[model samples]
Target: MIAIETTGLEYTYTDGTNALSGVNFEAKEGEKVAVLGPNGSGKTTLFYHFNGLIKPTRGEVRVFGESISKNNIDKIRKRVGIVFQEPDSQLFAPTVYEDIAFGPKNLRLGSMEIKNRVTQVLHRFEIEALAQKNPSNLSGGQKKRAAIAGVVAMEPDILVLDEPTSGMDACGITGTMEILDELNDEGKTIIISTHDCDLAASWADRIYILNKGRVFKSGIPKHIFADEKLIAEAGLKQPVIVQTYREFRARGISRGEVPLSVLDFMDSVDVKVMNIRCAIAGCDVEAGDEVCLEIKNGMLIANKGSNGVTGRAVFDGKKGEDIAVRDVAGDILQHEGTITIIRVPGIIEGGSRAADLDRVRDILSKNKHQKMGAMGTSAKVLMTRLGLVCDFEFDVIQSGILAALRGFDVTILASGGMADRVAEKVKEKKLKYSCFVL
Candidate 1:
């Protein structure tokens, strides 16, 4: 189902400035869509049409198959929440808590329900500490979080964010994206306009490039970034990952689909294992022999022997690397490690219990060697409150899977829908894993 669609969208300011012209766009239900463009490219103007913030000068804007108009504008606004590029534009209440409670109050929700919604958003956005602070007194990133929380408090089905991470720090950006992913998992359509090419490539399901008040190109990230001419013509730089992947392909080091992330790039590298003469004296190895491979002094060494042929694993290796090799058939070794997922629940109706934290601690103590990761806002907040640090923070799911492939035990803490996402990604990688809920 299409959540939002615009046909021949044209918006002109009162001062004779045309912000959007013949812009046709659509965002599917529960999709993560990105609108990319340089400044003054009509990205903001197009976003305003999604929620009926501004009427188009020409053409139509539809939300959930209904044309947006004054008769249904109130209902449409309730269904589609918009977070502006500038936090100050959205936040005006005396306190952050009030700012978040504004939307729900306008909906005439019960006072208790409105309070609950504001509280949930504050905690979800990790802005609970700033709830009572004046919005004008908060930092740039804090103000952004407060603004987003204000919109999310309305529980809109479609979230439209303009430059959501414009003033955020690295950690703030990661946490915000994780929260958005969690919302999307729960079937919210997430539409964001950003100048960050790398973020759009890695996070968005589809991207639309806007130029001169029109959509210059629209496609998946791989195809959008692969066209150097299009990128240059739009006055945008290719994502760093795409640039690096192109260079690797040119150097004959990588093949297959263009990589959009670090994990994809690693998967694209063509690492080949070659059979070579035994480097160790008096050592013999044959095909179809079981041998233990370990990295010693930056070299992959086969310890056991059989028929004078030592399998040389020609790939990057570091000292102290010990990956158990079960079979050496055709000089290929199979290696795998366990991945354990811990599902952290959202804030309980009353409050979370200390037993939950204890359970997590017990799991951590049992898996001392496991690389720990937390996915989504709830999981990260729980980990932080428990005084536990995560080894993988930004790309927790892919990072955990990568570590498991490298023969390292991984423990991921995920909340709500993200737990299912972690399991799905791990299953896609064909790795054995376990999940526990606390």
Candidate 2:
């Protein structure tokens, strides 16, 4: 069922401000949708209609097939919970618990049930520690959580958020999106409004671009951002990562769909870069081990690795084995010069399911940790299994090596087949570089 739908959705302010015009939008149940536009676009105005907070001047709004009118406003409000952009506006109760409990309390639910709901929201948002704090005393991130906790306590089927991460730091923004991801996983339909195209592109399944009170474009992010004319007409630029990819494309250096994030962009950078030669030394390394080495690129290059096995760097980017990085290379840090890579896939031969991908979501987003993995037997089939919301095409070993050359801080070393082959090439060139294993 469609969680929310609008036809010719038009709204005007009492003083004659034309907020929205003929905006037809739809979000199916359990889907994550994003509304993107500039400051004066109708994003906020459209959000108000989703839950019947504002009466439409023209057109109609529906929630689960029922028209949003005075008679059903209360019921729609319950199912279409909204968390406004500003936390101060939504949080007026004296205490955090009171603010969270406000909605359920209004339903005249038994005191015990309200208590249970308040507790659940606090835990879900990871705000149980702040349950007794005054709403005014909370930090900006805390207030945002408390505000969202209020609406979530209502058990809404569809949740509406307006620039929920507007004033947050990196950690705050990541934490907030993580919660929303979890909520969506729990079956709540999500609709959000923001000017963050990079974020929307990386997260949303579908996006609607609004301009001058109308939806100028609507589609998946890949197609939407590729349209130069539509993006220009809507007064928006492509996502930052897309712009970088295009710059590479314009110079005839990169190809394929634009990457959605830094890690993805790393994978997309041409992987056929020149291989470096180094002197061989240190303990012998196998399929799953860590090695430290250095090289030259004007600056001395160092290789870093995570504690886990780096099995990804050895696989033929297609079918030899499943791929994953050391939670550091070809996935996390972004830098601006050349570096050398030394570690190889560290997992013992025939190893599989080394770590749980689901648990890494928490580590990756807020902590800014790097990650790459797939639960398959080949690189060709090892993507889209983590529910990351972004698309990627990477030759694990080559991508890692190229990323390291382009100044990636950490990367796995090449082992066995590729290592031996590259060693022969180094001998053929008789360059100063030598081969080493660990």
Candidate 3:
């Protein structure tokens, strides 16, 4: 059965930006389809259409072969469940339990039936203990699970998630994937809109590329991901494993094809090492991993950025330092030279200057932490919003300053503290060039 289908689907926002145009696709029952695209590529708009949240500006949308019209809107909504991109947007009930039960209650189920459904969903999502906890107090991953549990309680035939695994740590990602897989196994159709190429490649049976408000390509993961030209054109980076293998090939090494996983790469390396042969002659295969493998000389490394100020430093083109060194009063500390160092002066109430608004904006863009309340919910977001890329010590900061003087592009460390010893570390590291003293 056709779970969902769209033909000539086109949508234009009120701002006059075209979000999607001429999109034609269909998902069969129990099929997993991944809509892959860069940011602002209409992935979210496409998903809204799936659940009838957004009426089509043009074209046709059918759920289970039933056209989405005024009479069927409510029915279609009941059959399709959408998990929004942001969990905070979906979770509004005071407690996790009430949030999960909201859908069943809206359906007007009897008190006993609603309790049973909510209990089953909470258990299924492994969030039984959080039933009484406030939604705002839940962790990022837990909040995501709660949002999903609420959707599952609806018993929708088609489960649509927007960036389902976004912002999750390794463990959280794995757990979510397992849950999705289990849901699929139970005969639910799953459709995901995501920018995570790795997740899409590993989990999606079929992949669709949406670019410039149109369908650029549609095929299996292996085929679409393997096409270097297509991936580059689509503004996506190839899988790291494939990139590594390609580099090896360019160094005069021969491999049959790019490996999809670590184990596959190791297997391919084994084959190449065992079958070493000159380019001028036919190859002879040797048994086992006994053949000698010779690597060409002259190593070259792609320098992404430098660490100090003096030694062949290349800036990341980010104007101004991440930390805005200011006095106890709010002031924009100016940089004196090419290298500047900043630090919090000491522990005084509101002693350090407020964050540089521009720098904060840049960090927010890079980390996608612009969503409201993200900083309050996740410590990682707070650190990142403050322009802390990686954890570093006071010693690193001082060393970075010295390295900057030596022509090494030095990076100032941001570990919030209020002490003379810590502040001295910032100066010693040569991070003091334009150091913002909070």
Candidate 4:
């Protein structure tokens, strides 16, 4: 079922301000969609139509394929629960429990059901401790949580939030996103409206950009961010990773796949042009040679004659830690005919942006470089830590390319992505190169 749909939606305030104009919005069941726009772009107005809070001035709003109207307003409200951007505007009770109970009470549910629903939402939001506390006196983040709890307590099929992380600190934003993810995992259709391009780039499965009270663009994060003209018209900036992609593409580099997040960019960029041999698993020990093997990136190289520093290098760019290379290279420096292998974990593209952030942080901490610059949202979480300017690339691929161009003969390359595929194709074409490790 279409959880929410708006066709030719238009709304005009009594003050004669056209809030929405010919908007056609849609969200399928169990979808996690984001509505992105700058301020005064009709995001709030569009959300109001979903729950029957406001009647459309022109077309109509539908909940589960049913048109919203006075006859079914109650049913629509029960199905679509909206949490306003400002907690103070939605939360209006002496205690958190009372505020949360307000919606169920309006539903006229049985006393036991209301009590159970209240308890569930409190526990779900981890705010049972605040049940008896006055919401008005709570912290801004706490109040935001309470406000959301009230809407969630209604047990709606669709949950709509307006700038959910809007006035939150770093920790608050993290916690809120976790809760939203949890709810989505439980099969609830989730829609969020925000002006945060960074958040939308990383979190949303699909994006809808609003401009001048209409949808300026609607598509996947990769495609939407790739359109520089649409991004500018929608009052948004391309995500940092997308910006980097444009820079790479402009320079005639092609990944054949556009990435939506920093981790995806790290994994998907065009590293083929470096022309190094494919990565292999193990190599036979050679005589009279110091082989410093680096298993960190799952790349194995056969050392024939290039013996300068013979030690393997593993740098995640973000951490600026070359300790793996330094340690093995130091040992090889003392003893000319020694071999060593080390494993280094780095950025991985997980299912969600939050997961990727955790992965990046894990890589940093595991590398024993914990003191990184603000590792929250944005490419800065990885970019700033890597200390990379435009002339420099943070990923290993670019570093290797630069090394090859600088006359350092690269022996081999390995990857779980395009590199692996390219290597197989090379083998088919009878082009001699390294094969898989395992």
Query: How many steric overlaps are in each model, in order?
Result: 1, 16, 32, 3
Best by TM-score: 1
Candidate 3 Cα deviation (angstroms), residue 363: 54
Question: lDDT of all the models against the reference?
Answer: 0.82, 0.65, 0.63, 0.63
Tell me the lDDT of model 3 at 75: 87
Which residue window of length 10 is worst by lDDT in model 4? 337-346
- What TM-score should be assigned to candidate 4? 0.65
Models 1 onward score TM values of: 0.85, 0.65, 0.61, 0.65
Q: lDDT by residue for model 3 over 1-438, one digit each (tens)?
A: 999999999999999888999999788999999998888888899999997888788998999999898888888988999999999999998999999999999888899999988987775566789999999999888888889889988888999999887877775676576556556755789998888787787678798999987899999887897799999898777877778778766765537666655434543453323222221101232222122221111111112222211111122212222211111111111111123333322112221234454664443344321111110112222345565553222123333333333233333323133123334544543344333333
Return the top candidate by lDDT: 1
* lDDT (10s digit) by residue, model 2, range 48-93: 8898888889999989999987788888888998999889989988
Which one wins by TM-score: 2 or 3? 2
Put down candidate 4 lDDT per residue, 1-438, tens digits, no spaces: 888899999999999999999999999998889999888999998988888888899998888999987798888888889999889999888999999999999999999999988987786576889999988899998998899889988878899999898887776676577567556655789999987787888778899988889888898887887678888877787777777877877776647566665545644555444222222223433233334432332233333234533443332221221222322332111211111111111112221222334444444444422111211122222343345232222233333332332323222222123244334433432322332221
Q: Lowest summed-lDDT stretch of 10 residues in model 1?
A: 273-282
Candidates ranked by TM-score: 1, 2, 4, 3
Candidate 1 segments exceeding 4 Å error = 273-333, 346-369, 384-387
lDDT of 4: 0.63
